[model samples]
Target: MVEIAMRSYWNEGPTEVSLNGLCQRAGVSKPSVYREFGNEDGLTHAALENYGHCVLAKVLEILAGEDIFAGKIRKIAYLAAEDGAHESGCLFVKMRTAKNQMGEKTQILIAAMASMAVDAYANLLIEGRETGEWPGNIPVKLGAAYLHAQIGLALDQRARGEDPRVVLALALCVLGLTDAQSEIA
Candidate 1:
């Protein structure tokens, strides 16, 4: 039932997915869903958590991977632009876009997750600087925020049905990657 709800929220926006619909589709009773998840907010929170683990974790993995900073950044672009799992768009990005309509609990979770992503990116930039993969002139915090924003923008474009190749090219370009280096797609 949780998996069904997560996928529904991923493929369709959370606002578009109703608890009643989820119950019916998951072959569970409304009371069961409520009992298990507490409420719509609880259910949404659960689904987002699951998405972080299942989908967003890949980005965290890339950040933590052995690849150079540029390679890691390129991989993130490819994930946003060409990953099969994100063909329908990113669930987190969708939720983030509609965070204004989210329940308080979900909103809080979103904020925390966004901050954590920035911190992770900052750490990656610090490592990159140490390894001389990128220049040390850029402030790590600012660079991290920039990278995070770029990724979100790329994912937003992908969600809007932009051509994957175009999205990849533009994302790489913004990350200072040349055309030759943007050939990962």
Candidate 2:
């Protein structure tokens, strides 16, 4: 029920949703909703945490696949670019924006979620370097920062109504993941 309410609020903005509306959509009583989540803010925070975990799980799954780091990162980039136009560019991104307006507890959760994402990218870069898929000279931390920056840029482009694909391509080029042979596709 909390998840449903959160998804509802995420899809449609907080101002557009009401407790009664969530109860109806979630098929739960008002008291039940209140019992689980004291207020709308509570529901929103829980939802953000749930959504953040979901995104992190998906990223981890992709990274855990059989492909090399470059291939996995490419696939992740494509997926992110494809979904860039909605909800302020991603649920995690939306949560980050919302963190500023949320209570300190919620802000901590959001920061932790963001840290997980950055750490995942850093680990992937380290693996890539170890496997000779990426240049060893490039520090994993720097690579992670670069990848995070690209995500922010992609989200910003989506917010500005710019072409995410073009921006994604440029980002790939900047990351040294693009070459003439790969471009043939």
Candidate 3:
């Protein structure tokens, strides 16, 4: 049931999916879902947590890797471009986009996830500077914020059906990722 709800909420916008629809798709009763999740907010929050563990964990792992900063950025851009089987968009991105309509639990989770992502990005930038893998012209804090926004923008573009290669090229260019477009292409 949680998997069904996560997939539905990931492919379809969170605001667009209904609890009853989830229950039907998951072959479960409404009361069962409510009993398990408490309410729609609880269900959504749980789904988000699941997504964080299943999908976002890999991204965080990449950020925490020994790879150079540019490599990490390119990998993330490719991930966003591919977006695996869920072609609609990122669940996190979708949830963040519809944050205003979400319940308090979901909203809080979204904000926390956003902050975590930014912090991860910041840490990566700091490491990049320390290792001399990326130039430090931009302040680490500012660069982290910019990279986070750029990644979100890339995911948003993918959701809008933009060409994946074009998205990849643009992201690499914007990040100044040293001839990565040609190599990645």
Candidate 4:
């Protein structure tokens, strides 16, 4: 039920959400929803938490893996190429893009999620630099920001109904990775 509401937020954005809609979609009673999550804010908060752990666990693993940015980017691009994965949407992108419309707690959670992702991305950039896989001329922070921005753009395009393959290819080009180098696909 929480996840259903979360997906509603991701797929439909803030304008289309309602407790009634969530209950109907989730097949749970209104009272049950309130009992479980306290209120809409609580429900959305729980939803984001559920999404971050359950739906995003595998993605988080890949982010924390030994692979460099190119490999990671290519792998995500391939996932985007897949039909189901492309349609599921990205939580960070959705939440970050919609933070201003969310409640205070939900907004805070989005900040935490975004900050954690940036930290992880920066760490990966540092590791890639150490291995000569990431760009040496750019500072690690800048490289991390660039990579993060590229991914955010790719996901945004994916959300906007662009061909996931093309969106990813554009991002890879921005990151300076050739198809030959991105064998993770």
**Candidates in descending TM-score order:** 3, 1, 4, 2
Query: Mind giving the per-residue lDDT tens digits that candidate 4 earns over 1-185?
Result: 87688778778875467889888899999999879877777888888888888756666678788776667755655654553754746766777777787788888988887777677767876776677675556666765676666667666777777655555555455555555234433
Q: Model 4 scores what on Cα lDDT?
A: 0.69
Instruction: Spell out the clash pairs found in candidate 4.
Output: none
Off by over 4 Å in 2: 13-31, 83-88, 136-138, 155-161, 180-185
Instruction: State each model's C-alpha RMSD to the native.
Output: 2.1, 3.5, 2.0, 2.8
Q: How does each model score on TM-score? A: 0.89, 0.77, 0.89, 0.82
Candidate 3: which pairs clash?
A: none
- By lDDT, the best candidate is 3
What shift in Å separates residue 146 of candidate 4 from its native position after superposition?
Answer: 2.8
> How would you encode candidate 3's per-residue C-alpha lDDT over 1-185 as one tens digit per residue?
88888999888778888898998998899999889989889999999999999988988999999888778877877787785753676889889988999999999999999999999988987887788766667777777778777677767777788766665666455555557666655
The digit string of per-residue lDDT tens for model 1 on 1-185 reads: 87888899888878899989998999889998789888889999999999999888889999999988778877777787788888878888888889999999999999988998999889887887788765656677886777777678767777778765665565445545454245754
lDDT of model 1 at position 4: 89
Clashes in predicted model 4: 0
**For residues 128-164, what per-residue lDDT tens digits would candidate 2 score against the true structure?**
7788776645577776777776776676566566656
Instruction: Judging by lDDT, tell me the better candidate of 2 and 4.
Output: 4
Q: List the residue pairs that clash in candidate 1.
A: none
Candidate 3 local accuracy as lDDT?
A: 0.81
Estimate the lDDT of model 2: 0.67
